[model samples]
Target: MGWVTGVMVYFVVWWTVLFAVLPFGVVPEEAAERESGGWRGTPRSPAIVTKALWTTVVATAVWLVIWYLVNSDWLSFRTGWLAMPA
Candidate 1:
């Protein structure tokens, strides 16, 4: 149960970081257009989504490594959170 809670916490933290960093890469192109007096346009490139997905994958990997290191002695079960004790 404790290990489940810890994993949930780690996931939440990882996602939060992912969102926070996303805008840095995703927003700059628009900001550049606005700064240059160009009309803001939608991101039509599939690369944006691809980059975000890749970033997510990388972030998840990093989070997993850190989590593993911090919880090296703990056992993490695969059951859903609701199945674990509060």
Candidate 2:
């Protein structure tokens, strides 16, 4: 794949990884009465920076694997492994 395509793929992968990583380490806070009168459970510390770092790491790894597969001759996108039923 071209560099631009690779970057796009990586971007998509990064967001996907970020979504998957979001719920990790999240703990529901204790129920407390809010002035707004709505019960919303939020984690005490979301640790967004840490989660973002982890997402980048995971997305990079996954993107590398996908890049290798896309650029390699072993797996051809033109002629896929499974034959589509007519």
Candidate 3:
């Protein structure tokens, strides 16, 4: 894939992974705490940095596999069964 496409793909993969990772280890704040301030569903300890790191790691691995397939032409659409009919 071209550099631009590769970057776009990575960006998408990163955000998707982030969403998937966000729910893990989440514990909502107590109702009493919510009354003091903040959103009702806010996590007491979101561990955002940790989740972001994990997301990056997972997304990188996934992106590498995609890059390999595209670069090696194993998943190429320009030829083979993936090619469009004229």
Superposition-based RMSD of candidate 1 using all C-alpha atoms, in angstroms? 9.3
Q: lDDT value for candidate 3?
A: 0.89
lDDT pick, better of 1 and 3: 3
The TM-score obtained by model 2 is 0.81
User: On residues 1-64, what C-alpha lDDT tens digit does candidate 3 reach at each position?
Assistant: 8999999999999999999999999888656354567776788899999999999999999999
Worst 10 residues of 1 by lDDT: 23-32
lDDT tens readout by residue for model 2, 1-86:
99999999999999999999999989766775587553569776799999999999999999999998887766764555643434
- Quote each prediction's TM-score: 0.39, 0.81, 0.80
For model 1, state the Cα shift of residue 63 in Å.
Answer: 2.1
Task: Give the residue spans of candidate 2 off by over 4 A.
Answer: 36-39, 77-86
What overall lDDT, based on C-alpha atoms, would model 1 receive against the true structure? 0.59
For model 1, residues 15-82, the per-residue Cα lDDT tens digits are 77666655553332354465566556544333556556766787777777766755554444434443
Q: Which residue pairs show collisions in model 3?
A: none
Q: Evaluated with TM-score, which candidate comes out highest?
A: 2
